[model samples]
Target: MANSRVFLAGLCLVLSAAILVYPSRAVTAAPNSAQPKLVDKDAQESIDKGLKYLANTQRPDGQWYPSGSYGTYPTVMTSLAGLALMAGGSTPESGPYAKNVRRAMHYILRVAEAEKDGLIAGA
Candidate 1:
């Protein structure tokens, strides 16, 4: 439960950070905006690298396997990775990572379908 809380907190942080990176398309701000810029080049670069790592590490099954002790947490990893990608401004419908996000969702749905219970614990 503590781990889940931590993970959820981290997810919230990522989602909030994304607001600073990408402004809302639906609601445009005024000319005298307080926060005009997204993220700095360095921060953006770091985000890019992190996103690239996730993209590269994603398996064909749309799951992510962490090294070492956390190897068994593929379901959680995939869920988090998908959320992270969404936080980075990519949706399952469209974005730079649209394909990756879509694939991840597909895998998730597949797992859910196979499980008699709705709990998605693994691939």
Candidate 2:
């Protein structure tokens, strides 16, 4: 019985490691949220352009805060930008600004995950 427990523990460890090293489906999977459903072409274009502007304004190190900025304004700006894109029904897989949105989503996810201890930020 003790040996069985050890073997199971080892197997579990290996499986957990594999899961961590493997790419997360969250990064590639379609969002399940009905709130982010796709929109018309023109609307999508607008969302894409807006996201483009936000991404273009980001710092080279992938941040919305300017150097020597005060308060959480940077965080707030980034958060708002992400929310706007999400509200416009954008995703990394299928959206008007899929690439830029994905990049922005990734940045916000990192911050949210680090601060909130969860991946429930952009989605």
Candidate 3:
């Protein structure tokens, strides 16, 4: 129980730090500039592609990178991926990737429930 609290507290701290360090909008050329428009389009495209990849790779169990080295850290990877989805403006309640977000949440909750210790440790 204590470990779980510590882990969750740490996760919250890291997330808070991330939000403080990275603004939603990237620093780019002036909005009226053609270069900035192109840059924004390219960035959006890259983000779309990345999100699509993540959505496609998600397991039925809602975990990601469930094999190889990453398999050792399923909870961490899942949380990070979920955070990425959220950073992209998707939430469990709404957004383009809402379903994915919910799945991740459910998976995490299930894991937490199954474990006597509340800690979300890697399998």
Candidate 3 residue-wise lDDT, 50-84, digit = tens: 98888888888998855786237777778888887
Candidate 2 lDDT over 43-123, as tens digits, reads 878867876777677664345764554544555565566456545555444455445545555565455545543433332
Ranking the candidates on TM-score from highest down gives 1, 3, 2
Name every residue pair that clashes in candidate 3: none
Q: What is the C-alpha lDDT of each candidate?
A: 0.73, 0.54, 0.72
- Candidate number achieving the greatest TM-score relative to the actual structure: 1
The list of candidate 2 runs beyond 4 A from truth reads 1-51, 66-70, 116-123
* TM of each candidate vs. truth: 0.68, 0.40, 0.66
lDDT of 1: 0.73
Model 3 alpha-carbon miss at residue 17, Å? 14
Estimate the TM-score for candidate 3.
0.66
On TM-score, the stronger of 1 and 3 is 1
- Residue runs of model 3 more than 4 Å from their true location after superposition: 1-39
lDDT of 1 by residue, 1-123 (tens): 444544554555446546635669777666675776778899999998999899989999888877877457777788789878888888766678878877777666666656665456655
In angstroms, how far off is 24's CA in candidate 2?
28
